[model samples]
Target: MVSCYSSHGMVRQSWDLFSSMRRSGFPGDGFTFSALLGARASSSCSDHAKLLLLLGISVHGLVIRLGLHLDVVVATALLDMYAKCGRVAEASRVFDAMVLRNTISWNAIIVCYGQHGGGKEAFELFVCMMRDGCCPDELTLSSLLSSCADMAAANEATQLHAYIVKIGFQDFLQVGNALIMAYGRNGFVQEATQMFGMIPNPDLVTWSSMVSSFAYLGLAKSAVHLFDRMLQQGIQPDGVAFLGVLSACSHAGLIEDGFKYILLMMRDYKMDPTPQHLSCLVDLLGRSGRIKDAYDFVVNMPFEADVDVIGAFLGACRMRGNIESAKWAASKLFSLKPNDPVNYLLISNTYAAAGAWSELAKVRSVMRNMCGNKVPGCSWIEIGGIVQTFVSNDMILHQSREMQKMMDLVSLVERYCNDDDIICNDPSLV
Candidate 1:
């Protein structure tokens, strides 16, 4: 009963039930506490993460009191709960305290660090897992690869691929799909295509990744071709695949195809449009100068718009120079994501572009009052198989001299080009 309730996110109910059991003199074991922990871990919403962490910590205390913390299964579940709650330090401490562990235990810890942006720490733990003679399964490889892709750590991804081939796990379809995502994210499209070809049979993820890769590169026609091929092969589509298709068609201003596929996804596939799909549709409509239609669509969404959807609407308003729409979207963002500096900066920039000095000042004032300081913009570039990071106004993080020289060269070169003619003419000749 606890397990069932926990899996469905009824954490409070599970706790009440557990309290009743405890009042009856029933001392819960590892499994009972594990179920409770699983309930808290099931939530993927960031807004509720802190509250869930508090509840999970309470459960951890009970597990320790019952002397069940040493139980491998219970410890693993406890670590997973911490990981899902965004408490990487607590998860690592729990993992290290374990006296015995299995593949699942190791995978849980790896996933904890990997998903939390500690890709290097996660990779080091993978090495430790090998030294301890715990064999890694497909889950381990896929999880680690996912982190590598998120970081665009091409070097690490390549190393993992070699290890996968050495261990003969390269043929696994899931691993193959991960490799495609990693390579594509790292700017190695040829390698991603090669991996895609090696998969004897492509699944939904494989097609989605392929489509997204092309769409990201603005290769809309190629993405459409791939979608057509997937349909010919009779592979079922999912929400994610539609997201890619919508993004691709929107980028190319293929509004008809975007709406056509979205309708097909809803009517034929019986899948509701994800927030990302809605965002893409907004972008498509905006690109085609359908500002009013896009605004109406957003207003009529069955559910409240999430961050992505609102951001997309804001971007469309900015692109079309619709200050009223941009201001409305900005108001939505102020309440939805008050702390994220990106949203504040975007609205301020839009206001500045439209010559709304008072509104721009207000946004900056709100940002100062709410966030205290601007978050330095950060970006990554993979050069010659190595990924380098640079933060705005921080030169010492990488090769400061080389980057400074590049910036100087770009600033000098831009002065010679006419903005009106530059778009259609060769930049080199300009």
Candidate 2:
């Protein structure tokens, strides 16, 4: 009853029933206690989790005080509670104090670590489990593989792949899909493709993974072809599948193809275009300089065009130097997200480029009056097994000093033509 109520978000009712049960002095067993903990954890009430912890601790204290047995099930529930409550440290403490540990205990802790971005710790624990002669089952490998993939540990992922093959789990669809995701995420598109092909009976997830792999690698044409083949093979495309198709079409500048798929999605499949699909379409059309069509589409959209959709159109207008459309898009974007600095910057840049000095001044003045906050630009690079992120105009290691030197060199370049007309007509002539 507690689990059902919690699952349905009826926290008050769950607690009321629990309170009544406690008042009746009915002794709660392990399952009842676990359910109570789950209800408390999933409740929307603030501090419900903390109250649950207190109740659990009290129960545990009573159990120890009364010399009751410390069973693995109770310990696992306790660990799960602590982990879910964002107290992984407490969870680890409980695990350490366990008199008997099982694979479930290990899996819970590993999942907690993965959720908290402690992938390295999870992987290390897996190693320790193996060193202690504990055999990992499919669940264990699945958890480890997910962590490795999220952390982009390609070498570790490859080793796990080898282990899966050795253990005859290579044919397992779930495992193969995970391997595909890992390889694609780590930029090993070729390896991911091979793994996808090796899955003899590919499910929807398998097909989506292959299509997404191409999308991620920017092989948009190949992705489109794969989606076509999937349809030809009678594989029904899900939302994720369409997302890949639309994303591929967007990146490859296949505006016509994207528009076709959007219509096909509604006509043949009766699937409504999600906000993501709409945003992609707007981006596609706007970037292709079909500003009027993009604007009309957004204006006539059945659902509200979210800030993301408007931003997409705005960015596309900026990229194409369509100052008129950019101003219009900016108005919609600013109305939707007034405090978004990127929109303000984009509008200001557009106005300045169009020689609307007064408009540019007004835009910049508005930005200045709106708390003086500006959006910062950032870039990331991965090298030698490490990823480095840097913000614009911020000193980023060796690059900061080198940047000034490059700017100085650019300033000193010889000018072949000083005439504005010639420079505008043919910059390469210089």
Best by lDDT: 1
TM-score of each: 0.85, 0.71
lDDT of 1 by residue, 1-430 (tens): 8888888888778988999999999988888988988988897777777888888898899888888999999999999998888789999999999999999999999999888888878888999999999999999999899888888898889989999999999999989999988888777889998999999988989999998888877889989999989988999988788888899999999998999999999999899998989999998998888999999989999999988888988888888789999989988998998898888988888888889899899989989989888767789876775567777777586578887899887876675454646645756644
In candidate 1 the C-alpha lDDT for residue 34 amounts to 89
* lDDT, model 2: 0.79
Q: How many backbone clashes does candidate 2 have?
A: 0
In model 2, which residue pairs have backbone atoms overlapping below 3 Å?
none
Q: Once superposed on the true structure, which residue ranges of model 1 sit more than 4 Å away at CA?
A: 1-17, 43-52, 300-306, 354-359, 382-387, 398-430
Instruction: Give one clash count per candidate, in the order shown.
Output: 0, 0
User: Cα deviation in Å at residue 420, candidate 1?
Assistant: 31
Encode model 2's per-residue lDDT on 356-398: one tens digit a residue. 8898899988988873867577675555545456786778578
